[model samples]
Target: MITPDLSGKEFKLFQDFILENSGIFLDINREDSLRISLFSRITAKGFRDYYEYYSFLRYDALGEEEFKELLSLITINETYFFRNPSHFKFLKEYILTPLISERALYGKGIKIWSAGCSTGEEPYSMAITILEVFGFYKNLNIEILATDVSLKALDKAKKGIYSLHSLKLIDEKIKNKYFVPVDKNRFKLKDKVKEIVKFEYFNLIKEPYPLIEMGGWDIIFCRNVTIYFKIESIIRVIHNFYNSLKNDGYFFIGYAETLQQISSEFLPFKWNDIFIYKKEMRDLSLEEKDVNEKETGITEKKIERKSFNKAILSRGLYSKAMKFFEQKDFSQALRKVREVLEIDPQMAEAHFLAGKIHADSHRFVEAVESCQWAIQLVPLFLAAHFFLGVVYDKMGQPQEAINEFRKVIYIDGDFGLAYFNIARIYQLQGEDEKSLKEYTNAIKIFQKSSSEKALEFSEEITSELLIQTCRQNIERIKGFINKKNE
Candidate 1:
């Protein structure tokens, strides 16, 4: 349906409405997204233009429900398990494990909150990380809370259900340990893990401070939430976060966000490639600096800035390569990735991309070499390892392929493709039961509310069609089993 364009007045109306209700400023840049979002519903409800829709949203009896529906459409919920594995790596090796171990000695408590935890992936991933580190000995007092403004999102979080896309970054071990396959494409998080996380509906901008208790939180992950707010509101929210955090409590902001021009209540601590802020001993509300604060501390400023610039260049090239790869222009894609590699040879992501490009062209030896380089630089790189497995499979080294695939599963329990390949190996070996189990696992990962799009063969073989194929194979295997017994 062709939805009408939103006039300036109508756009202003929505901007004001969103700001007044949620403290989120929908500026000129967001007009297109707002227009598209409203258009989808406006046309469905037979409204002609943005003005009519605005009036209906403001005055109609069903305006409230319509507004809720609009919120669901407009909000960004693009998240996956352990979206940034580096941060998870930091959390485990540097921050969490030590803190928990020391606190365990004294039976102290830890409080962690995932602010704006869209569909609960962040918090659930956190729970899985903790489980990986601590195992079943849950002696220490721990409280984990997940909050989001969208009631619909919170409801999904509370239900603890997710698609394989959300679990794409997760390993098969974590999936097997913490999640039960609900069907083809959907997985339900285990009750033990789900019970540890408390999901609540709370708008950061509109809600009052201390939604759970009065401060003293050891860590608060408020990443990507404040980007929607106006500068004034962002300042207020950051202040609230600072006051809410206990002394030396950790505060994590998203990569695109900075405490720079807004607040100085926290000190930025540089982790490799990322920076997390720590609450200072002295209050800085009064001693706030007017200058835009640098993201990293001043000592390593030059090195970090140089590296950041290099990363920017490499990323721009890598992005072009991905676009080329997506369009099936493998040569140009390879060229772009090579440009990235020249600028930063140590870039594991670029190497991974080059490996994918080579693999797509069926140059298995080159693909293997590129993936090996990626593994050398970033050993836990799941994509590189998975692609290496694919390369080995194509090279007719079934055992070698199986070994690499198992490594991916070991790293991320929810990697269904690894299971799918393993099942294929079992089938080749005439192990019907093992093959059926693996195929069932893969099918369970792919069955979802919607069909997933194809991934150009780099990854993600789990789609509705693939799930059906797996089922057919399972049935065929069953037939073979029955005939053999007869």
Candidate 2:
């Protein structure tokens, strides 16, 4: 009889299969979860051994259905009603208000897409946003298309049922108006809101985006969705999103995600505590064509951002200082940065570089102060944020570090280094699933920059580092599970 202890070879094959089919790029870290999920599949299929099941999946006509089920079982669908209140707040206060007010004048349709609408909460939440903003605009053609790859999830989405636990955080007024009690513990969505949203199954990696058929949506919420794929996958998906939006359409993402790595086709816009993107109209002229062609072929480049500037330092002195610092001479480096700063107090780059050195030396408090000063001088500088995040991480303040990293991506999405650090934090927090997603985001950007050298290094490191971490953790978790059984 076969058991769920997948062999190293079989596991690798299964991981590759997931990547090829779903663009989800799994590592050994997910092995325990995959084993559990896959065990259910095997047992349901009446398979005894791992090899037999593997062969069956490879040769059987039912493999595709089973594979889809595997994705459904392993995919993280931890969404709640009106989660991340800021995005919806922005939509209601800024986006929906303005769009509906404008539509009132033009008598046009309003369309939105919740691109990765897990369990239907996001789309339903968005529908509520429209209702709240427009109030009596029942005359307006307001439509929301909610899509996900899991048929099981989509099925639930269509039903629009939520447990009382999921509704606990919702405002009573919003809940009462939008959902009516169906039974002791169940609630059905009011017909008014139900008619506005249509749930459909979509694979961001495979199936054609249904948003195309729905026409140019006025807004799209694809937050935290792209953090799960390789660089090519991100590029493909982002471009598809760009194509699906109307001119000046808005895109919303998780606060932790940004379009800095994706493209400049979207312009950053901020509202009261909420951030979103507006699609910039493309210039299709020949000059624009040249730029486009250059962009199309331009590979992802390794970031070589200097956290600190050297111009403030006397060239000879700076070189000498760097040599000392490289030799682990923190005192000398600190003195050199001070000397340079005394000569040019506003030298943002120099302060940042000093912060980097301090951060590397584990002088986190000094690093934070220096980075904060550098940012004060040059707010758009990415080095300051990166250094600040590192300092926060060293101090064991992960949320602070996460905020700093989020700022880095906000200014520069293509910052593969920041993504790597963010992934590390998530991993350390026992959020391997989230870490895997972030690692994939970094990989996608590295791939796009066609940064073969850096990409090779990352692939080598993550394949060893993250894969091993996952395996070890999974083993630990399984041990605990087994002990519980006993």
Candidate 3:
């Protein structure tokens, strides 16, 4: 059965509804995604159109329950054990180790909240790491609270049964020790690991945070969760996470997600190559004190000042790096960029600059690594994608280069230079028809832009210059086609 197409009005209604209820922002680009998610329910309910389904979902007596069903369909649940090994490594070495010692002294338990925990991998992974670090769970006081809005995912998590694909990162010894194979491809987590993690259904945006009565969480893992939220929603959620954390407790977000513009309440800390935020320690007794209270007054100012100083220092170093890059001093540029990264590892632009410098110096391997780091830090980084494409092309990997260029176009449809590069690659591969099509695309995009507008990355090439070059390429490709016909 075909799913009815969602009209723009209906799409907006659903987008608004999702945002209001769950704080998930379905942008204009996600129209097809929204449609597909609602398709099953729309068809199942015998609704002929999207509007009818939306109406039923909004007005019917069981609408709330139905909405939960919709959420299950739409919510992203892609995860795996020990994802981003650096985070887990940091957890064991930096976070858990110190906490174990301190908590041991105080005879208190370690509390971890894995907010937006999908299918239990994260919290379970944490439990595994905790058990490994402490050598056993019997004498240790540890609490792992894993929560998600997706009831379906939580159900699966509770079952503690997983496919081999989900355990891809697990070592053989660890896998054998922590899991019992249920079948050829499935494994059930050992009772020891499962017992520690408590999976619950809690919406980050709508539901009140759990376990606050017990005390603030010692650590919170909400990685990759906030990317779906709007800026305002992210702020609200981060604020809640901040309040829900003990002073000096750590907060982990996805590598691609940064709190730079969102909030400065938490101090950004680097653990090896990975960056995590730390809730600065504060005096709880001074909580009710007025701003005029001298000791407490300076605390807020100190945090702001520290954040300001770091920003200034990183920016200054980045400026120097850019200047060196422009001056063709690759070594100096690389050095300065490294300094920028050392100060602010989350600076995606610095990583991109470092990648560019490496590429310029003909260090393709280093260049690729740096560009990848930049992309991992900021997934939608256009410059990094473009530069990575260029590096791949220089390394004689035409298909890889094309893939990166296509990503640039995907991220920004009007990136005429990406089209131009793709056309050039096709031309080199002796594919005249494909080259002509991409050249035409380049010309069309360039024509829509101001003639004087400089192309991204290739700032020396204006829209007019690119359009003229594309036209020449189109004519050359046509000549090749005509000769083949003859």
Candidate 4:
């Protein structure tokens, strides 16, 4: 069974199909990966190409079975027990105690919905943590509904089998007590632990609460899963979760999944360095809303008639600086940047621009200082860190440059320049293997961004141009590696 390289059109069609059915956004860079997986299916069916395979899956009766196979390939079930222990720690110390007291007062059991509970580790882990913290599970009724879109994953989850990697973060005492060793490097969850979590095939985006009785849950653990969706789909899914929660009930999300950026339906509360959202309190009077907003730092004066003229002026100055910088007029750019800094001293972008202008004029010392200031103002500013790396690289500090590049990637994993520049640095240092790896990473990331039609970080740089350039660099590096070997 020969697996053909997928054409751009074919990849886009397949991407749309998957996203329409399940709210998973397969980035364009996954074309190669998808083609390989599709090949396995195509080979099994003796299909000629992806088009035929897609047709069969769309029209044929047995397409349902084939889709399950395809879904198992596409869906990333990369969760392990206690992956983010901070979340669990917050739940145990802050949430569970209140829940216990609240449940006692109400004479009711607590319900937890682990939306996208891939392979049961998360839900089961939650069950174990709860049992440990509560000290006697029999007294309190806790219903854990673990749901996933993939039937294959749900099946695996119900069996409760996991390898050593899944158990790596689990404490030895917890492991010995809650999980029994099944085979070498394999463990099966104890029945007592498994009984609490009921696994079901569920879709968060399309499916409304179809099966479960809507008794309202104390908490909903829908972490990490939302990252697979686009921002719009993410908003829809988060809204669905909002409706599912009881009033004032807590909703736990993974740190990586930025629901805050997508939706404002849930009220965010900081718990032990973990941000959990709650259903907005019902029937808050106007006064109460004002008080609530103020506590959250959105005060009356801060929100009402705030002067944007200064902000507008700062943006104008920044724009002028950028124009000058682009036109290779470093002195003029420096003047504009200074004007922006004078107006808004803490403007990270202005500081970053100043650094870039300084770098242009070979003022490495001033460049480094400006970049440091930018970083101090906004530590997670990707461009600032990236330029700082560039400044360091020019200043004969490879290690510092690499560190800043790494920091950029740490803040934003999708940053293409960081990957590409790091790869270039590695190539310069004769680290062929590392260079190739970073180059490949940059190519993959750029491919995805190209497919998305917008570049991340730099508004001016299109993903297509970046991808093409990265590809050329990759080829050059590869040729060099081959030549070096010869």
Candidate 5:
């Protein structure tokens, strides 16, 4: 449906309200488009202005149904089947196969959550992927929780109907076997496929996640959800995801996502084209040994392991350096990180920490040098590449930024922020279409990476903040390119 336009004040009011309630920061320049979309809902509600609609939404003794209605109006639900195929491809190879093998070994079931199910295609797709993987293991108990805020959509999903267009590239046999003819041009998922999935309503932003408390899940698919959330909201939701997973459980996000900046507990590993996060498992063996020693009356001395000590010292120095840098104490931060290097020359963390301080202080040469050193210390240091990308971006070398971001993705395919950076650079270079693709990719990754467990360890990604902190960069690039052409 075509949305109606709103007046400037109406646009601002609506934007502010959404930002406050949903933590979705609408770009000021998107006022007109946002106004059109938001105004459509007001019109649908038979309201005259946004203020009235906002008042109604806010003061209607807000409840689940009301919030779901609001979310239905606000959430963008544009999605396609097997859209971004590489992520699913990776899932088939690296993630699903491994999980199936593990489930067989342990004689346990597998559980998956499609956090933003959106009319059921994504979750259905996930179930299909699992089915394809465990074709022989038919007795295995596998289930998918397909949840979304739109009950209306969920209603449609429960009907298990879809247009043929949405089934592009699906194997003929799988389609024939899994879906039964419903009408002239539609199909309903077969009972077998439908039985494996449970449809429900869920809101990522506000949650005591519905099913997570009942049991920990093996994998979560939350792709493309976080692009709409504000930074703080994104962190909160991600932390929630982290807490929801079992130990060593995997979280699958979009091809363009990463948790390196968002959560510390999640250890992101890239296989093929997808970024999956594994929750850190505590070393129960050591704890058990300590308990045993205590019971046996053995004095188990906790010796100061050099590697452990060095990590502690390095982290402390890195923390102090961050504070110094925040206070604009470049020299001191640099000195502190150098001391960290002295303690452990091979510390990539120290190198990255040093690189950040140098980059922030406008010491491009030093920043580049430090970043390069970090990259050399550990070529897979995604943060170092991100920092280097920032340095290049600041130095007015969009191409360089693009290169550095690409390198980051090469090292870690799910590096969402790097995709964001690449998108920004492409936008700067007048590649608006490409930039949009990259931005969407980044958003996709961010959404998929979200989990209850991830949310607990999720913190503000300083690099993301720095990268998106200003609106001036886009305008600056626009003018630069325009003038260059003239």
Candidate 6:
């Protein structure tokens, strides 16, 4: 039997249904992908058309089971061992190193949850990282819980078997240590690694989290999962994750994902080149106090409340500056930001805001200086680097601008606007191939983002606009390449 085509109206109906049931937002750009997945299921069920399948899934008694099948087919389960090595490195060095020492003092156990852990690679990677760092000491109690919405992925994870493709990043030594060769192309994870991780079916949007009642988690990893979720659903899920975390607990999202505009409860912390969020900032302050006392004999008890009052005053001034900046009142914005800087000279945010004001006022030199100051204060400040690139571009220093954008990418590889800007510069320079590649990269990121979500650091550009522009640029670049070849 021939597969019936999915109409535009039918696509929207299914889109709403999916979002309502699973909290996954299926954008217009993903209609083709959704159609492809639907075709097979439609055929398997011997349905006449897309509408019939949709109705059956929505109304039939077996609808729940069919929906699960649809989820298995549509939900992306692509993962590899040690997919993002920096995250694991940060876990070992910055988090676990200090954590184990602190917990050892208190005789406490460490709990880590890998949310949306597909095929067990991520949670297993955490297991290996923990084992490498602290070993299996009797005193060190560590619990690893991995959960996913897709039962198909969880089943595969529980089996502890993986293909060579999934183990591509693993070194020979690590492969030898943690995995046993099942065949030429398949490997079975050693029991030691598999036993530590407990895999479960968890719907982030639908399920009530019981783990929080058990004294909360020390760490949670929910990487590359929320890209498919609606904005409201994302907010709900993130709020749940926040509650499930203990005071000062660490939370890691996908490198591409951000908590900007979603939640402010977690403080963003950059460790080396990796960025993670912490539930409480007070712990960092206390940790810093301990370090300072070790180096210069400064006691935490000696810290004054006056400094805290100054911080509060500066924050109020910064808010006023941000309002002025948003209104495009550059002079007032500059004055307020300066007041903020006077109160807290080391406030990187104030400096960054000042840079924006200077840039808007066409004072390129001052803009560069302000952005540089912000970078000096916080080396991994992404917004500072991004703004510096914009200032360089305005100054007609494309090379310098490209360098700054590359720095932003080095810090956060999934920054789409950086790729978009780089692509535009390449297009202007007539580097068709490079421009096309960068445009494609930008599209990949922006497509995953919500269509209506306003991009960070941009005045008003949304993900939908970026995706459209990138597609147009890619097509133009391809056309230029074809003409040159002819």
The number of the candidate with the highest TM-score is 3
Q: By TM-score, how accurate is candidate 5?
A: 0.53
After superposition on all CA atoms, how large is the RMSD of candidate 5? 22.1
Worst-scoring 10-residue span by lDDT in model 4: 449-458
**TM-score computed on alpha carbons, candidate 2:** 0.55
Candidate 6, residues 271-388, lDDT tens digits: the string is 4566788775344476787897898774543343234346547766877898999999889999999998888787776888899899888899999999999777766566678889
Candidate 6: pairs in clash:
none
CA lDDT of each prediction against the hidden true structure: 0.76, 0.71, 0.82, 0.77, 0.68, 0.81
Task: Compose the digit string of candidate 1's lDDT tens values, residues 234-336.
Answer: 8888888887788768888887789998987687767667887777654334324212134334433344445545655676687689899989999999999
Across 413-454, the per-residue lDDT of candidate 3 in tens digits comes to 767888999999999999988999999988887887222221
Error of 1 at 474 (Å): 37
Task: Report how far off residue 95 is in candidate 1 (Å).
Answer: 2.5
Q: RMSD per prediction, one decimal?
A: 13.8, 23.9, 20.9, 21.4, 22.1, 20.1
Question: Which one wins by TM-score: 1 or 6?
Answer: 6
lDDT of 4 at 28: 80
Worst 10 residues of 2 by lDDT: 300-309
CA deviation > 4 Å runs, candidate 4: 1-3, 46-48, 60-65, 210-215, 284-486
- TM-scores across all candidates? 0.54, 0.55, 0.58, 0.57, 0.53, 0.56
Q: Which pairs clash inside model 4? A: none
Q: If both were scored by lDDT, which would come out higher, candidate 2 or candidate 4?
A: 4
Over the stretch 293-355, how does candidate 5's per-residue lDDT look in tens digits? 688754222221233345446656766876887788889988988887897686665677777
**Candidate 6 off by > 4 Å:** 1-3, 46-49, 104-107, 137-139, 281-486
Query: What's the lDDT for residue 365 in model 4?
Result: 97
Q: Report how far residue 84 has shifted in candidate 3, in Å.
A: 1.2
